[model samples]
Target: MTRRPIFNRRRFLGTAALGGAALASPAYLRRAYAQSGGEVNIWTYNNFVPEDFQKQFQDETGIKVNVRLVDDQGKQFNLLAAEQPNPTVDIMTVAGHRFLQFVDSDLLAPLDTDRLTNWGNINPTFSESDWATVRGNKWGAPILSGMEVLSYNTDYVSAEEAQTWDTLFSEQYSGQTAYIIQDMMSIVMLMMGYDGNMVEYLDDPDTAARIVEEAKQFLIEKKPLVRKYYDSGAEVQQMFVNQDIVLGHSWNGPAAALITDGFPLGMAIPQEGSYGFVYTFNIANNAPNMDNAYTFIDAVLASPEIGAAMTRASGFISTYKDASQHLNDLERKATSFPDEQLANLQFFRAEANELKYGLVDPAVEAIKAA
Candidate 1:
């Protein structure tokens, strides 16, 4: 079995055909359950579930594992909607904010924590978040967490200067700095003196509109400094490797990948704080193999061994508290955030949807026009 890079665009797009199929038919559902000899079908992003863990689950439970990959949450939701009457996907890894949409649509099943023996091992920071629970019902298990952090080529910029978001907008790096297209809003919000959490600003229409305008103006002002607006972390890594860009924004995983590959790369948690996100494991409301789904969640997701392996493979932090014991010093530093940093981190809350369409979309348009 060949291990593929976790963030390859080619691999993610390879499963596009599956996304177009009308999935929830009675015949299709039956086949999904019966075809793999008692397999559990999981729909998630590529490489989020490591191959070794999949094999381990099958060995212990005598149940085969079939994984279907999607490129993003939008495509995952479209595919799930197609599988209406009885969704074939027994398990899924969904973004924290998207979980609220799933709950609002009645697409997810409430988790039975009683069956998840290792549930108590999860860190309170993740387990206690409103993102994991909806209206007092636990909708999913927090699996991995990460931040959208600043990364700089240490040779080009001092580590001390990279410690603030202001470095990205500095005159010295103009025409040499890069930013992810998707992160514009969060970066702009951080620049505007608002905590990067969109939830707080979204409560009132006046505040939301004001924040939107401020973010737009910030982006427009910084447009000249941005060398490129990339679509993926892998793209940013490539630019850094080629020395095409010296400073940029990146997710922890891709930045860690660069560091592991011996690049003079360093991830920074700015004084304003890093933008955070969590990935949760949720069961389909009409999962064909409910018992096997629960078993998989308990045995694999909650295991410290699995968490350690996943962190080593992907460079994203595991939510299981005991998992830290299994990590080596380097892996621990790469994956885990310090308590002070964690306290300042602003997670991508449920209001990101509104911010995306209502704030970010127009902001991007304004930048293009400028």
Candidate 2:
């Protein structure tokens, strides 16, 4: 599930366990009516709200769509925070890692499944995710599935070289390597076998401090080899296009986009392993057009055709189970995610393990300065 699909089976049982259980996040058993009209102001990735579907939705339901593009979830959180008690946005995309942070910041409203008709069609892996469920309320609706992996210019890197994280830090790729400053640190820690329990080990301040320090120093030492610590997939894509990075740590979406564009890009999950993530739509707490947001969410989930367009456009897998069935042979190849990835993949933790982010961010800044 190796003709392997990018995501062919259920994932996130461990993730769901982290939340105690999936009381509110699972595909709802009850059906609900979908409302229409007015407007839904959404902040999502470009191409996520596909144009053809938008046109059809408006034509059929009279709901006006206003989409504000977002590239980084951290910035998206800040934008919502600045607006405070009255955010101008209606629905915004949130990653699993940032969902708890958003909820803790009081930026999102818990979803009411009675309002989303297609909620039942979502795969349990995404629908029952830990990110959106708190207590008994669900704050996010799953839309896209993604992962963290290594991608390289196939023209430059051999498949054997792409399988190990060591290649990124090796002298062979010096002055030609890149990675995002976020979770990539933890991946490095894991790759180094520093702590099998790295994320949860932060429960003890001393232990977490030591681990963070070690990770920081390692990254600092390796800084010269990196061309950039990029902020977005587009940056990595451009770096590849510009012949700037021979190999880079990237999200599956960006690598898929590169493949679709006919780049000789090769993707690997790294033998040491990586993490998988899901992107969901979180309604702003004080959204002015709440009903329209629900209407739009349902419309998107209800159609596999639109889901197919979205997957083709964004390179992320559709959370709707039937969506990929619509992809053609070429698209299937471009968006292919090997089924064997399940062996080394784990779901990422949300709530950011505060001690980790707190230590890592400053260290990264120091690395950038040095």
For every candidate structure, what is the RMSD over all alpha carbons to the true structure, in angstroms?
8.5, 9.3
Best by TM-score: 2
TM-score of 1: 0.79
What TM-score should be assigned to candidate 2? Answer: 0.86
Tens-digit per-residue lDDT, 104-166, candidate 1: 677898988988876887888898876778788888888888888888887778888877889
Question: All models: lDDT?
Answer: 0.71, 0.75
The residue-by-residue lDDT of candidate 2 on 1-370, one tens digit each, is 0121222112322321222221223222122333356888999986687666676677667778998888888789889999989889999998866677788889999899888867987888778866558768888888888888889887778888988889998998899989986667778777767552356675676877787777778888888888889987767877877777889898888787667656678888888988888888888998988888888888778766666777777778888878778777656776665677557787777644466666766866777776
Clashes of each: 1, 2
Off by over 4 Å in 2: 1-37, 130-132, 194-198
Residue 362 lDDT, candidate 2, scale 0-100: 80
Q: Each model's TM-score?
A: 0.79, 0.86
Alpha-carbon RMSD, candidate 1: 8.5
